[model samples]
Target: MVQENNNKGNQISRRSFLTTGATAAAGFMIVPRHVLGGKGYTAPSDRLRVAGIGVGGKGESDIAEFAKGPADIVVLCDVHDSRAANSVKRFPKAKYYKDYREMLDKEHKNIDAVSVSTPDHNHAVQAMAAMQLGKHVYVQKPLTHDIYEARKLTEAAKKYKVVTQMGNQGASGDGVRQLMEWYNAGLIGDVHTVYCWTNRPVWPQGIPWPTEKAEVPKDLDWNLWLGTAPQKDYVNKLVPFNWRGWWDYGTGALGDMGCHIVEPPFRVLGLGYPTSAEASVGSVYVDEFKQGYFPDSCPPSSHVIMNFQGKSGDIKLHWMDGGIQPARPEELGPNERMGDGGNGAIFIGTKGKMMCGTYGMYPSLLPSSRNKEVNVAKTIARVPEGHYVQWVNACIAGYGKKELSAPFEIAGPLTETILMGNLAIRSYDVRKPKASGNGFDYPGRYIKLLWDGPNMKITNFEDANQFVKRNYRDGFTLGA
Candidate 1:
């Protein structure tokens, strides 16, 4: 998706600033200096009041970072009280709740923005709720669990007229802009092929669900944690982390790091949606003889090829996970590391190649020495305040008054591109009974699935379409 430049010629008036400020500081006031006799009077108009959902771990850090700017942590929500302890301790004055639904319903008027750093499954619901309340939202990466959710949230951002930003901090980094400038400067000419690899799924995957159920933590509301996912008993090590391996909760290694890894090429090339997708996955053997069948779990490893119709020509992007790295370019020295050791990306243009580490960090020309020789003019502005604070400033500046690095307008398509890889990975295991009623036939395997991007479908494969939009459990909706 091409983002419209909403910042052009738009200015924030003092009246609009105060109006937005009052909404953020609703039910509370920043004492004016006139009342206290000239100590200081920072206008509440200068601040943004933010409520955080899933305020633990990454969420904890997200809230803390937002607090570093002109923003206040007014409310916090998380399913597990134990996980939320540090944030609760740090923002003691902030009200705490276990259910995000209740927290937003009660506190929406008091906060101008919502920060969501929850699991992949809950991201859409939580973010959509906040946006529906006319509040700006900052969501963690991958944006949503399914393609449909990403599309809905993207549209809702514009519909609600809210400021939206995804939590892929790399989109705001200097490295990506540098890569963009180099590409724009023709240092790398017309990238037709791209490779993005990651050493991830550091969590368990490609295994059957544990038959045994663990007791729910005393502090955790298991039902709330499940959210839109199917009803199920709690499993050990599924909370605080490790949910990434499950199909119901996480988007696997591709989703875990794709936004950060694939973003550089996507932005530098101005990519839209992929026209086709095909993937091959690494399998796990149950014993010594038979391969395991765990459709609910993500594969141990995968390599997906996505074909996008770029502006200049067709661009083929390759996504590899679980320690799979592409062949080193001829220009790169054998001793030189590829993409920060374990994770990185490489772009192959007609004239040359360039690579970067994860989060678009440490970008360099293929020869590595060429980086020192090239002096491209910096065309893109850098986010010195970093990603989290950028959102806070944008929220304070009001909607469309300032530009964001990963606004939903841009992030939605990037997320769809990432999830498209997952769709292929999931479809890789799709099976059907053979005519003889024999073992099985995996039709989705080794076949290029044609994509109808705007319609969100795999035209050639009917079974693969099942994953395009998931059915949420009862009592949950996208709420768009």
Candidate 2:
């Protein structure tokens, strides 16, 4: 059975924390070297004790990365035994559980931090619960499944006074830092437009929900796996992946790759919640005569345009997915690859344009020749430990002791900005009965949505607002 952690001794009291340094010092738990055994011995207090939820696939890799640093992987939790098997075998001494709540209830006293790498829908709740217990959190990219959840996690990071980091590893990459330095140097000359594209939905999309149900795998705790999402019977081939196309469990292509592809621009431009959002989606024809209307699944392809108020003036950002891409910049050579061929982003400024591949890799000038001619002095310090190790060290350093690359303060707005596109895409499919009652009218189509960032509302489009926050299943809640 699941249990709430209320033990005072296990919880860190709420307090205001302001981190200033980049160094990851062990969080106020320093011990004399002689106290342990010898000069070369490291004290247990210096290591961060971490518990991992969703210990499979990316989660397994995330935990392993943390283990590579001064962190001890002590507890492992996942809804499926088969998925957790590899991690369990690797971290043989670590305790294992299928439910995260039970693990936290019993092991909170031993854990100093938590790593959350579950599906997008479960990210917020798991991270929130860990934070409320005073354990620092390192959550996977896109932060949360919904805009409201992202906003709340941002606020909670401050209210709970816990160190937090998002798993958009590119935020910690040298490439993004290079882009920042160039932008700060005025090389790009005020980026007014940006285009990010991806060839995603490598899995199925724009398809109907499976009508047939399959027997639940014995190794899987189906109910727990469905945490926070509406209850539904088991479906084949949706376990490890393919959930990205569904609104109920995943955030589609934008959510899957947006954090990695759009992050460089967000960092370089200091972008926040968009002022307005609009989108156009490509449709899939079910048969020779009918267009497919799978409202529950993402479109085959989509192009979303969002308007943001930048430092100088208005900025327009475009997001493309499902193999769609923007026109090639004129400065590039005919044989030159754009954005690593499959995924990339281009920033267009007053003077020039720059582009980068996914995860902000391989940032370069439009002509590619300028990269050799012009050199900007590096201003931002790189994280030598990389994204995962950096988080582990920061957790040991405690809240307010060290700064993080993608803390919720920055990640929240970035996530909300990226998800704004999804909101517009979902809103586009809103169907309503016509006054004559003969057929449906697509009122949400071909319209720009006005967004109130502070209030998290679409002022002009009432129907679009529904996508901002979704209802959770009865057993789950994003607790304060």
The lDDT values for all models are 0.87, 0.85
Model 2: which residue pairs collide? 27-396
Q: Write the per-residue lDDT of candidate 2 for residues 291-384, one digit (tens) a residue.
A: 6656778888999999999999999999999999999999989999998999999999999999999999999997999999997887789999
TM-score of model 2 (CA atoms): 0.92
Displacement of the residue 123 alpha carbon in candidate 2, Å: 1.0
Cα error of candidate 1 at position 144, Å: 0.1
lDDT of 1 by residue, 389-438 (tens): 99888877767878899999999999999999988877733366555332
TM-score of each: 0.92, 0.92
